[model samples]
Target: MTETTVTPTHASRTGGRHDEIRFGTSGSTGEARHWFRLPHQMEREVELIGTRLVGPVDRVLNYAPPQHLFGALFGQWLPRIAGVPVHQAWADPFAPLPVSPGERVLAVCIPMAWDLLRRSLPVLERAGSVVALHSSAAAPPTAHELVRRAAPLLRAHEILGSTETGGLAHRPLLPEGPEGGDAGPWQALPDVSFVRDAGAPTRGPEELVIRGPRLARPEHGTRPPDRWATGDLVEFTGPRAFRLVGRSSSLIKVNGVKVHLARVDEQLKACLPQTECVVLPLPDDSLAGEGYVVFWSGRGHAVGIADVRAALRDFPSPSQIVELAGIPRTPTGKPDRSALFAEFAPTSA
Candidate 1:
């Protein structure tokens, strides 16, 4: 392995019809581990996304990194299949879109990048029918509204899934709704099926077991079940759709009370509508072993811990409040959670 590269576990053999490439997890804990994917698996995933989301696209405007699932499909695979040109929007954030009016363009971007481009949506108004797909991380409904309002003809889709699952589901968010308004249950993509695990605890939310061709081959030494039981908790709204409760892993105990980190994020965003927040768990020494830390950003808006605590009386209080220009994120647009956690986590003595 190179100095900058740490090799992930996988087994591959070349030459002949037996050609296959496998990818390992980025190091998961305990018995549960991520699966390996073959090239065909990747191809099948891209096909599903292109058919359901990027239908007959003439060009791809990719602003996300090629390493990410959303970006790789748009930047490379989709463009290859569509015989269309791809403009590297990440190369120049403010540069004019390489698109014209009435053209079909699949614009792939992330939540953070969208926040910046949303301001310049007026310029993209002339840029033809853009099917803007936001993924990698959750995008606030306001971000969708901004783009929808600015580009009146823009088609918006929020793909809900991870690098491990490809794209499990996608919801059409066209014409955007109010900031705090719920968009309802997410409709699962074709070729995917969901099952509620029977072994999940009754006291807390339940886990959803997903099984599909787009999924990875069980690699870990664990029970290697046919279906992957994702940590994402959900409440069934319909047969094919479900409202995401939160990740089971995101649950923490505070003062003997169960607190959902996702709920904390939602409440903080609701209280401070203008500001963006990322709620993190820190080591609590007192009654609760886990203390909550809130990181928020509103540009020019000044938000204080006391004020936020006042706004949220029904929720548990945060042990700390950190305000910054914006939430720090990884190159792939995922929240730099480890960095955020490290900011307050005590260093070794």
Candidate 2:
């Protein structure tokens, strides 16, 4: 009898094996966890997202950080699954991407990146090959205007979704209007379904919940529900369309009146032109609860506490307003509300 030797093939150097999927998650309670996704699981995610994101002749350029879920799936895995040649820009998107003009280029960038591009509109206009600009993290309306003016062919889309659920929906940033607008309904890709709260009313402002094939399994020691309550509050504008109101966690009570932060944010932006503002709740001892505080970021803006209070007259009265050189933004460009409150809110001794 002859003994035969078998060689073991090592895992793919690109991280885990094609069969083993790795996911990084920060749960609703704000705990970080990682899980291994079976080959089939990852394949489903690719199938669900690829059809929506890629085109027959598209070439992707990703500047999103790979560590985050949106960035990992769309920026890294999706291209591999779709078999498209992606140009991973060495330079940050907040800065100019390393590539020059080329045909059929699909650009995925954050709002800050778009803002930078807007600042250099003349240079962007020269990159004629740019076709689509899909933005997430945060919506940059001003930058959207710049893109429209500089590159007519470039379409800007604001995608909606989070770590727990992948890119569940998208809205258009250009040709802004109600009917047949570029922003499509907040549609589930294929196998995904929105879980509604039975206790709540049938529609409008229901807790945004999710259940789908790609829905991640909860980690050990966590009382994970099969369906994820997204913590987002959404209103159904149409049968399939929804407008994100704000996070349920972000809801604050002022003088026994409930106020949504996003609503206040809208009022502030409407009142203070060209200036960006975020309303945060500060812990109050006298109130035996929390009070409102606002932080605004912009240049050449004369927004004052009085002006802000006047603007918000029709809305909830905020406790105070502080001027900031720039808002402390998350890596993805959304305001870091907690950080601001922690640093700025006066401590009661």
In candidate 2, the residue pairs with backbone N, CA or C atoms under 3 Å apart (3 or more residues apart, or in different chains) clash, namely 21-37, 172-183
How badly does each model clash, as a count of residue pairs? 0, 2
All candidates' lDDT scores?
0.66, 0.59
Model 2 residue 175 CA deviation in Å: 4.6
User: Across residues 1-349, which tens digit of lDDT does each residue of candidate 2 receive?
Assistant: 0001111123324454444444555332245555444446556665654556544424666656555555555566667776777766524454554445544555667656666656655554545556443534455666556556755646655566655555566655654422223234565556667776567776667678877666543434232246767787888776556777877876877767888887787777666757777876665557456567778776666666677777788766666677788777666566665667655755321
lDDT of 1 by residue, 153-225 (tens): 6778788875556678888765544344776678999888987656754344667778887764444432224
- The TM-score between candidate 2 and the true structure equals 0.79
| Top candidate when judged by TM-score against the true structure | 1
